[model samples]
Target: MEEKLSKEKIVQAAFQLLRENPELEKLSMRKVAQKLNIQAPAIYWHVENKQALLQSMAEEIENHFVAPKPKENWKETIYAYMENYYELYQQYPCAIEIEIQTIPSYPSRLRNLDAILGILNEAGFSIELSYMTITSLQHLLFGMLMDSSEEKKLYNKVMAGDDYLKKQIILMKQYVQEHELKNISESIQYRQKEKQKDFFMKTLRVFLNGLDTFV
Candidate 1:
C-alpha cells in the first residue's frame, strides 16, 4: 500500500521553495511536488489549490508564535508582544510574504489577536479601540516588513539602468551627481540595510506615545 501524502509534507516543500525564492508570485504547486519527490496530483490531495497551500503555509508560520504571559502592566504586554512577533517572522522572512496576500484563517492567528484584544481592553481601551489597536499593529508590521522587499525590487529594476525608462534614469543620475549623493541604486540598497536595523521597538514607542493622548 502507498503512504498517503500529508499536508505537513506539502507545506514544508512549499516553504523550502519560498526560502529559495521569496517572491510568492513565482511559486507554483508543480514546483513544490518536484521538491517533495512526489507527483503534483499528490499535492492536490493535500491542498485544493495554491491558495489552500498558502493558507496551510501561513498556519504553520503563525503556529510558531508563543505569546508572553500577561504582565500586570499592559504596556509591558504590548511591548513583549511586538518583540516576540518581530523575532518570530525574522526567522521566516517568507512568512511575511505569505501574510501579505490574505489574512490566514488560522486558529493561531485568531487566538493571538484575541489575546491582544483582551490585553488592550484590560489596558483601559474601549472595545472598538482595542480592535483598532490590534489592527494597527498588524498593518504597521506588514508595511514595515514589505518595505525591505519593495526596496529590493526597486534596486533590481534600477540595475537594468539602460532599460529603466532612459530619460528618468539619466535625470536621476544627473541629480545625484549634482548633489554629490549616492546613486539611486545605492540609495535603495542603503534603505534595504536600514530596514534591517532595529526599527520595531522605536516604531512601537512612537505609536504608543500617540495612544497616550488618543486613548
Candidate 2:
C-alpha cells in the first residue's frame, strides 16, 4: 500500500521546490511530482490545482514576513516591517512574484495592515493620512524589494561600473536637446536621477515633517 501523505508534507515539498527553482514558469505538476517522487495526480489530492498550490505558497511566505514583534515606536515598527519584507523577498523572489500576481485575502497581510494602522493612529495621524501613508510605504518597499530581488547582481554590476547609466543619460540628454524636446527628456531624466538620490528616505522624511499638521 502507498504511504499516506499529510498536507503539511505537501506544502513543505512545495516550499523546497520553490527554493530550488529560479523561475516559476518552469513549475508544473510534473515537476512537482518529480520533486516529491509522487505522481502528478497525488499533488492534486493536496492542492486543488497549480493556482491553489501557488496561493498556499504565497500565504506561507507572507506569514513568515509579517509576524508581530515588540516595537516601541511607530517609525521603528514601520522600518522593521519594511526591512523584514525586503529580506524575505530577497530570499524568495518567487514569493514576491506570486504575491504581485495574486490578490490574497490572507490573514498575514490583514494583520500587518491592522498593526500599521494602529501605529499610525497612536502617532496622531488622521485615518486618511494613516491609510495613505501605509499604502505609500508599501509601494516604496515593494518597488525596492522587487527591483533588488529581480536583478541584485546586475544592479550591483551596473552600479560598480564606471557610470554607464550616467553616460547613457548624458547621451540621451544631448539627443533630446538637439531635437528640441529637452523638456520632456529632462523630466524623464530628472525622475531617473531622483531614484538614485534615495527618494524613499526623502519621502519618509517629508511625510514625518507633515505629521504634526495631521495631528
Candidate 3:
C-alpha cells in the first residue's frame, strides 16, 4: 500500500527541496510533488497553493525551535534566545526568506514571542517598550542573516574569479581611503578584523545595554 500523505509529509518534502536548492523562487507545489512522487493536484488538495505551502514550511521551521529557558537576568535570556534563533536560521537554506514571507500566526512563533515579552515585562519594561525591543531585535537578526546570505553568494562568485566584483571592491576601498573618510574606513577595518558572530554579539550587547538604561 502507498504511504499516507499528511501535511507533515508535504512540509518535510518541501524542506528537502529547499535543502537541495536554496533559491526561494524555484520552490513550487509541482516541485514538491515531484519530490514526494505525487501529482501536483494532490498537493493543492492539502496546501491550497504555493503561498500556503510557504506558510506551512515557515511553521515547520518554527516547530523545531527550542526556546531558551527563562533566566533571572533578562538580558542573558534575550541574548541566549537571539543566539539560538540565529543558529536555527543558519541551519536551513532560505530560512530567513521563508520567515520574511510568512506571517507569525503559528503556535511556536507566538509562544516564543510571548516568552520574550514576558521576560521584558519582568525586567520592568512597559508593554510598549517590550514590543519595541522585540521588534528591534528581530529586525537586527533578520537583517544580519539576509545580508550574510547575500554576501556569501557574492563572495563565492568572487572566489570563482568574478573579476568585475573584484575590481569594484578594490575601487570602493580606494574611494574610501582617497576620500579620507576616517570613521567609515576604521569601521570597515574593525569589522573585517573580528569574526562575524563576535561582531554581532558585541552589537547585540550594545543594544541591550542601551535598553538597560531605560529599565
Candidate 4:
C-alpha cells in the first residue's frame, strides 16, 4: 500500500534534500516530490509554496531544540539555552540560512522565545530591554555561524591551493605590523589561537557580565 502524504512527510523530505545540497535555492517542490515518488503538485496541497516549505523546514529544525531548564539565576538559564541553541544549529546543514529566511511564528520558536523573554522579565528587565536582549543574542548566534560557514568555504579553497586569500591575509597582517596597530594585531593573533567554541563562550560570558550591571 502507498503511504499517506502529510506535512510532516513533506517537511522531512525537504529537510533531507537540504541536508544533501545545503543550498536553499536548489530546493524545489519538484525535487522534493521526486524524492517522495510523488507528483510536484501534491506538495502544494500541504505546503502552499517554497516560502511556506522553508518556514516548515525551519520549524522542523526548531522542534529539535532542547531548551535548558529554568535556573535560580536567569543568566545561567540564558547561557545554557544559548549554548544548546548553538550546538543545535551546528548539527544541521544550512540551518542558519533556513532560520534567517523564516518568521518566528511557529509554535516551537514562539515557545522558546517566550520562555527566554519571560525569564528576562522575571529578572526585572523591561519588556523593551528583554526584547532587545533576545534579539541581540540571536544576532550574535546567527552572525557567528554565518561567519563560520563562510570561513569553512574559504579554508577549503585555501586547502585547494588558493593563494589569493592567503596572500590577502598576509598583506593585512603585514600592513597591521607596519602601522604598529597593536590592538588589531593582538586581536587577530588571539582569535587565531582560540577555538571557535571557546571564543563564543568567552564572548557570551562578557555579554552576560555587562548585562549584570543593568539588572
Candidate 5:
C-alpha cells in the first residue's frame, strides 16, 4: 500500500530532515521522501521542486514562532518579538540560510512583521521610517546571528584539538597588544564572549535607545 502524503505531512518530513541535517547545500527532496518512507513523486505532487520544498520547510519552522501580544511599551514588545525569532533561528540552523535564499510568503512570518511595524507606527514613527528601521534592525541581527554561529563552530573546532583557533587567537591578541591606540588594547583584552541571546538583548536595548533620538 502507498503512503498518503499531504502537503502538511511533506512539510513536516522536510523539517525533520533539516533538523537532522541543517546544511541547505546537502538537502534534497528525495532525502525528505526517504525520511517519510515515501517516493519522491509523492513529495513532488505537493511541493513542485527544491525551492518550493525549502519555502515549505521555512513555513514549518516559522510555525513555532509566535508574534508577541501587544504591550503598553511597544519598543519592549518589538525587542521581545525579534529576540524570540532570533533564538528560534538559532535552534533551526537552516532557518536563516533558507530565509536568506528564498522569499517565503509564510503567513505567520508576515503577521509577525506586521506586528513589529504596528509597534513602530503606534510609537509615532511614519510608515516609511518604520519599514526602514525594522529592516535595518533585522540586517544588524542577521550579521550578529551569523557571527555567533561562526564563533560556535570555531570554538567547537578548538575543542576538537584544532590549534588553528589557538594560533588565530594568539595572533589577534598580539595585534591588539601592539596597537598603540590608548585603551584599545585593554578593551580587546576585556572583550565579551557573551551568550548570543544576552548579547543581542543588550545590543537591542542600545539600538532602541538610539532610535529615541529620531522621535
Candidate 6:
C-alpha cells in the first residue's frame, strides 16, 4: 500500500531546516528531502516546487508580522508593529531576505499589508500615501536591522582593541593619501557609530514627519 504524503509534514521539515541553518543560501527541495530522508520526488507530492515551499515559509513569517492588533494611537500602533517585525527578523535572520522577495498578493502577506495600511489610513493618510508609507516603513526597519547586524560584526572587532582599529585606520589613511582624497574627516565621520545612529534616527523622524504632512 502506498502511503499518503502530508503537506504539513513537509512544511514542518522545511521550517526545521531553515531554523537550524544560519545561511538560507542553499535552501533547496533536495536539501529538504535529505533532511527528511525522503526522495526529492516525494517532496514534490507535498510542495508544488521550491518557490511554493519558500512562499509557504514566507507566509508563516508574515503571520508573525501581523500578530499585533491595531492600537488606539496610530503612531504607537505603527511603532509597535515595526518593533515586532524587527524582533522577528532578528530572531530569524533568513526572514529579512524572505520578506524582501515574497509577493504581497499572497493571502497572509496581503492581510499583513492591509493591516499596516489600515493603521496609516486611520492616521489620516490618503490611500495612495498609506501604501507608500507602509512600504517605506517596512524598508526602513529591514534596512536598519540588516545594516546593524553587519556593522555590529565590524564593531565587535574594532572594540576588541585599539590596535585593530589603528591598523585599519592607518591602512585607510594611506589609501586615502595615495588616492589624494579630500574630506577624509567627512568619510570617517560618516562611518562613525554616533553618526550612524543619528542618521538612522533622523531618517525615521523624517519619514514620520512626512507621514504627518499626509495627515
RMSD of each: 4.0, 6.0, 1.8, 2.1, 2.7, 5.4
Runs of candidate 6 exceeding 4 Å displacement: 1-5, 69-72, 149-170, 173-206
Q: In model 4, state the lDDT of residue 96.
A: 94
Q: Which candidate is the best by lDDT?
A: 4
Q: Model 3, range 157-199, lDDT digits (tens) per residue?
A: 9999999999999999999999999999999988789887887
TM-score of 6: 0.71
Q: Give the Å shift of residue 7 in candidate 3.
A: 1.8
TM-score rank, highest first? 3, 4, 5, 1, 6, 2
Candidate 3's clash total is: 0
Instruction: For candidate 4, write residues 105-188 as lDDT tens digits.
Output: 999999988889989999999988898899899999999999998898788888898999889878988899899999998898
For lDDT, candidate 2 versus 4, the one ahead is: 4
Candidate 2 vs candidate 5: the lDDT winner is 5
Q: Each model's TM-score, in the order given?
A: 0.81, 0.67, 0.91, 0.89, 0.84, 0.71
For TM-score, the strongest prediction is 3
- The worst-scoring run of ten residues by lDDT in candidate 2 lies at 195-204
True lDDT of residue 196, candidate 3: 76
State model 3's lDDT.
0.89
Tens-digit lDDT track of model 6 for 1-215: 95456776776677788777645667888988887787889888778987788777777766666457766788768766766676667656467777676665578777767777877776788888787777788789878877776676577767887687769878988898888777875667576646544566567767776666558
- Clash number by candidate, in order: 0, 0, 0, 0, 0, 0
Better of 3 and 4 by lDDT: 4
Instruction: Return the number of clashes found in candidate 6.
Output: 0
Candidate 1 vs candidate 2: which has greater lDDT?
Answer: 1
